[model samples]
Target: MIDNTSLAVVAPEILLLVMACVIALVDLGVKSRLRNLTYGLTLASLAAVAFLTGSEAATGETAYGFGRMVVSDSMGNWLKCFSTIAMMVCLVYGRPYAGDRDMLRGGELFTLAMLSLLGIFVMIGGHNFLVIYLGLELLTLCSYALVALRRDHTQATEAAMKYFVLGAMASGFLLYGLSMIYGATGSLDIATVFKVIAGGQVKHTVLVFGLVFIVAGLAFKLGAAPFHMWIPDVYQGAPTAVTIMLGTAPELAAFAIAIRLLVEGMLPLAIDWQQMLVVLAVSSLFVGNLAAIAQTNLKRMLAYSTIGQMGFVMLGLLSGVVNGDPVFARNAYSSAMFYIVTYVLTTLASFGVILLLAREGFESEEIADLAGLNQRSPLYAGVMAVTLFSLAGIPPLVGFYAKLAVLQALVVSGSPFYIGLAVFAVVMSLVAAFYYIRVVKVMYFDAPITATTVAAPAEVRVVLTINGALILLLGILPGGLMTLCAQAIVRMLSS
Candidate 1:
């Protein structure tokens, strides 16, 4: 067995696990008035874990004797920080909503979210097939339960059912791919697998076939085109808080896993997978954006938009086009990571509004529902506009910065395809802007559907303030921020 002492590297994850269990036990007999206690415990532990991770040496090496099963790098560290912050925001937004409904949203939900975070950390660091599989399943299992957190809701039940049935099949596909990769390379470790492929001694067909399965499984996780059918339903059906977790946490996890496998394990075969990813990216972009255009439900629309965003992320990962420079890999990767962080925050803020809007019998799921919101409350309207503009990739927002980096990355190769894709992405951003701006327009320009609807809580308003400021701050002064992203990604890859 691996020596337990080596777990110091994973101290954050360990703390989170212990805290999760303790929270669950404490919550079992806790009084209703004290439900917020679980939130406190979770936040304290999460904050500690995040702080401890900052002290981890940036060795960029595999850990203990999982024998290439785990690795940690600056990339994982950065992503984890964002994921932890996002989950904490979810807890802050979830506390009142869960309590209002008398739901078991305290320790149980917190525990599961923490477990899912552990899986994400592992997924990001996996240096071997076994670790990746383990991380994937842990995340999946946690999500399936999370989807059904409101067990009484038929929509939640149905979504969970669909997620489980399809998720199991995807897991099976993942296993088959891993087995094939092992068969081709004679190893489950990523470094060894890469070495085997790099040597050109392995059978090409088996490696390629295995890659398809792995890519397909990842595609499902990311809710990419052709594999994204479940996303709309799941996002629409799950509790808004749960949807927030899924949208933000799982995407980061999936992005990390993709990078680990494609960039680290399968680097030698870039020519093979790059083309495939491009195709997937293009398809996802069109399908996701076009599908989103028709959806009236806010959550479902954002779900499709998330898929579209992933397509651009894939393009960034695959394009490797960096300005006029030939070496664009690191820039491209960093830009994608930055984009994911921004996306997660923008998404969380939107969902926070949804949670605040939701009551025992009503959920603010429709566009019309927010009509004249600006007239009623300029503050909410302003926050909503910030989110909408960010999503639309307008100037000065972090979203614009993300797209600019991607476009710059794609500009490296200077190919017609790259140019066309950049243009297409820009065009789609405009299209997306229409939908997002519509929300703002309705919120501000129209009359309120009801005068005495409900006022947003102080916490919700605070969430809006923080989220809006970040978006605008990054937009206005993106240079220093990009420098930090540059440092993080460069060190991550080089070390």
Candidate 2:
């Protein structure tokens, strides 16, 4: 029986859904001058959802709804809260950019973004394979549409098609893998599958085959190397606003689903999946760093940087279990969760600046376009510099602490192979630093490429400042958020 108690577990999602429809309908009557109303309402809805999620997380209770297909717990709630804030900040940063490009003409961007967040909520809460896949499709479908929203732009259209085609293929890979697991285990519920696998009766060959495809699907979604063909194209071709959305928030959902399928549902198969993740991590670090150094376009460079970041995230995940011991699970997974959170924070600020520098008829995507950014807008330039330094894992920045946590987790495993993985990750970080620093150099040392004053809405400026400050603050005082991540993971595992 679906009771009020069960329904309350998903109250935020329900509220968000209703608000989304309301916003879509309200947009119909809003004129361009009054379009801010629609944007304001969207922001308001996100804030409310965040509040609800935060409240739920504060209770420190884990609840299962819909026959355990959906869960409300610390990890999921915190992720939802952060994802909402990320989207809110994204919309704030995206408004001027969208308005200048006429992408806001029909209020579709706002609606689509909210719908995507709903997908994120679903993905985070899902505890069943079908439920998770439904969420993934919702997110991907919304993303494909948003990428192509600039229907008149050939590049956007092309990028959208590529994303759709590749995304569909990945989905098929994931579905086949899930079906194989079901056939082997006789269930689709994640907990049931885990129990079945733990029973030691599943066919080894079939399970391994399914694991491979599942990892491929996950790699594609996370934009890890060898499966990351879509990221650069999509980031460069899509509107910068949409690119920011693509880069930041969906990542939280990806992390959640990874935890659900690999950690929560397939821990018995950890040795197998761990081997796969190691290869993905190594290739991602190697390719992502090497490829980024050659990119002149800022967005494309960031795309490659994202690939490297995902590699690090994977490193933490893969190192969780060694020799059938799960002693390091909490540390490793929590580090990964922290890494994703910090990465999303830094990414939002990095892309936020790119979006801010974009004027009408100008995309500001080229690294050269940021020449003399220090002279043109010192404040924004500083913000961008902080973010870049953070991404490079420079000390006294949140990104550095994020990296340290993961490396520490890797080292804690006491496995020489994982220790070597840690070493390689550090080397890749060094290699990746060159491209990141190059952006700062261009901003500070080169002459201005454009003379127009770089002005943005006050809200964008305030949010960017806060975003940049948080990156620095969290880096300097990493204990609080680190503890939060650790606690969330502990709760998740315990429940």
Candidate 3:
């Protein structure tokens, strides 16, 4: 009953596992100061895996592998490819910063990052609830270790503890909700769960209650308001390198799972879940923008920005099913996918600049610390300014197009509630823009706090430049990536 075809679908994941283990062993003989060896190996592994994913997607075959426990489709493959690229960029941006903070001493950061990426792969490909949960736990466990990597720092330790406790509770909520669904539907496979729900014999009350918990769990994962108490503390307290790792790539993984659980596995329950998302979205937009304006810590401010961004993503999701009309589902979900991808790209560049500014015995974490960034380095200041503009949804930037796509998705639904939601989101963007622009003002208008010359590794410079350029380039020519996202969603939905 072994299927070689199933193995083919997961070839990249298998290769990643082998590479991670090899790196772990190879790192043992490597010296601490020469951590570049570990970094090179990690990047090589990601490159190889990304190549494999691209090849898989090119085959244009949707593979139901491992007894349907996992799936390989264009959507999953593309996400995997981008996730690998994101992690590679993260490591590139994080390297010198990690070196300054003594974080690369033992290769733990590299190893943990690789493992977390492996977990993301699993989450993206999983087709069974148990498989998805296992992947979620894997990613969270690695994240906990990474957050606490700077064990000597009291703040890091405290952040790690808080993350652990809250993350555990969220896991419990998701598990209990999944168990209830299982008890009702008598299936562990996501496809089967959908079929069971579609059959219309399940208890309505039980399923709805289960959905309540599932949404709560997802809100926690997405860092949406009311369940987002942990993001600010964790983002502020963790090492900037860890914060960059936590912010960018994992979001793509999170988006994948959200698609898997809500759209794919629970489509029959759209009315219920869409209503829940509306509530989460409105609250997140209201709270995230309002809170971000008050933050002096740059990381914490970005954390709140993250919450508001997630709200936009939720708006797209909620608009997918208006009054039981799923005619616009693909458009809505694809728009959300596009939004998350662009947000992650902008986030990486924003944090890359922060990492570049940080030096030994100094953490450039406060917004005021960005004073005269334009004077120190106009290139990076321009990069940071573009990044902020993108986040604020300014025109001629990818973020603006992303927001436009999602708003269009909402308007296409032709529902008053969704239209109102779009208006509210626009207002929130305006509120959020004030803080983002304030950072740019400090960078250009205020005086330099120190005379430190801003310099990054050559690799980091190249990557950051490409990252910033892509945001603007995509804004100008949004067709290619937008088409790719739409095609992936359509293909996945059809298969």
Candidate 4:
């Protein structure tokens, strides 16, 4: 029977759903070119949701709802809070860009984005395999529609088709794996599967087979190497606003599910899965860095850069269960969490700058488009430069600390293998620095492509400044956020 506690557990999600529907209907009456009413209502809803989730996370309570199909715990609540805030920022930065391109003729973009965010909330709270799968499908379906929202553009339509076909296949892989696990354990609940696997009653070969498919699906979602074919095309082809929306908050959702499935549900098979992660991480580093070097398009380069960054996340994840010991589990997972959060923060600033530079009928996609950006608009150039430097893992930046935290986790494992992997990651970071620095150099040293100064809405400028400042501020003093992540992970594990 549903109770008050159950309703409270999903208050934010319920609020988001209702607001999305309301905004859709209200947007039908919105006659402004910018859909100001729809935009304001969406932001207000997101702010309220963020507040609710933040309050829940701060309480550090764990509550199970829907007969244990979903959970509201510190980790999930914090992730939801962060994801909501990221969505708000994405809409703010994307509004002008979307308006200029005539993509806001209807309220579909606002409605679709909220629905996708709601899907992310479900994925984070899901405690059962089927619930997680349902959430995944909801998020992917919305994404496909958003990518194709520019109905008149051939490139956008093509990107949507590619995303649909590839996403469908990945979803199938995940579903099949979940089915095998369910068949083996006679349960769809994550907690039940964990206890069953720990009991060692199931066939090891069968479990490992299912795990292979599960990891493959997850790698595809994370845009890791070998399964990241859809990212670059979609990023380049879709509207820049849509690309940022797709790239930012959805990533936190992917990380949440990774923790839910791999760490919480299937950790008994750590020995088996950790090895698979090693291969994926190393290959992603190699492929992401090398391929990025050949790209002239900024979005595609960042897409490849994303693959390389996910490798770091994988490294942190694999280091959690060294020699079958889970002593470092909290630290490792927290480091991974920190890495992803900071990555998303830095990505917002980078993409915000890109969105600002792009004018009507001009894509501003090529690296050459940023030539002498420093001379034209020092503020955005500095923001973009800082973003690129952080991505390269340079000293005293959030990216450097993120990489350092992961490497530190590996080294603390007392495993020569993990330590060596850390060294390899460092080398790859060095390789990645080349492309990132090249972009910086273009902005600072190259001749200006246009003499007109870059302009932005006052709100965009304020948010962009804060976003860039956070990168630097967090890099300098990352302890508070790092501690929060560690505490959240510990609470989740203990509860």
Computed on alpha carbons, the lDDT of every model, listed in order, comes to: 0.80, 0.94, 0.91, 0.94
Judging by TM-score, tell me the better candidate of 1 and 4.
4
The TM-score of predicted model 3 comes to 0.99
Tens digit of lDDT per residue, candidate 4, span 1-495?
789888988899999999999999999999999999999999999999999999999999999988899999999999999999999999999999888888999999999999999999999999999999988999999999999998899999999999999999999998998888898989999999999999999999999999999999999999998888999999988889999988888899899999999899999999999999999999999999999999999999999999999999999999999888899999999999999999999999989999999887887989999999999999999999999999999978999999999999999999999999999999999999999999999999999988978989999999999999999999999999999999999998887
Per-residue lDDT of 450 in model 3: 88
- For 1-495, candidate 2 gives per-residue lDDT tens digits of 788877998899999999999999999999974278999999999999999999998888999988888999999999999999999999999888888878888989999999999999999999999999999999999999999998899999999999999999999999999999989999989989999999998888999999999999999999998999999999999999999999999999999999999989999999999999999999999999999999999999999999999999999899889899999999999999999999999999999999999988989999999999999999999999999999999999999999999999999888898899999999999999999999999999999977788898888889999999999999999999999899999999898
TM-score, predicted candidate 4 vs. hidden true structure: 0.99
Clashing residue pairs for model 3: none
Candidate 2: residue 130 lDDT (0-100): 95
Poorest 10 consecutive residues of model 4 by lDDT? 1-10
Give the alpha carbon lDDT tens digit for every residue of 1-495 in model 1.
666644655667778788888888888766765376777788888887776655452443434434546666667776777778788888788766776655564466888888998888778767788888898899899999998988778999999999999899888877898899899899988878878898999888888999989888888898888888889999998888788899997788888888878877887777777778887888888898888889899898889998888888888888753333327778788788778778888888778777766776778899888888777667767777888788888888888888888888887667788888888888877778877887888888888887755565576678768987888898888886577667767765664
- Could you tell me the TM-score of candidate 2? 0.99
TM-score for each candidate, following the candidate numbering:
0.95, 0.99, 0.99, 0.99
Candidate 3 structure quality by residue, lDDT tens digits, 25-102: 888988867487888999999999989998887676798988999999989999999999999998998888888888
Error of 1 at 491 (Å): 3.0
- Model 4 lDDT on a 0 to 1 scale: 0.94
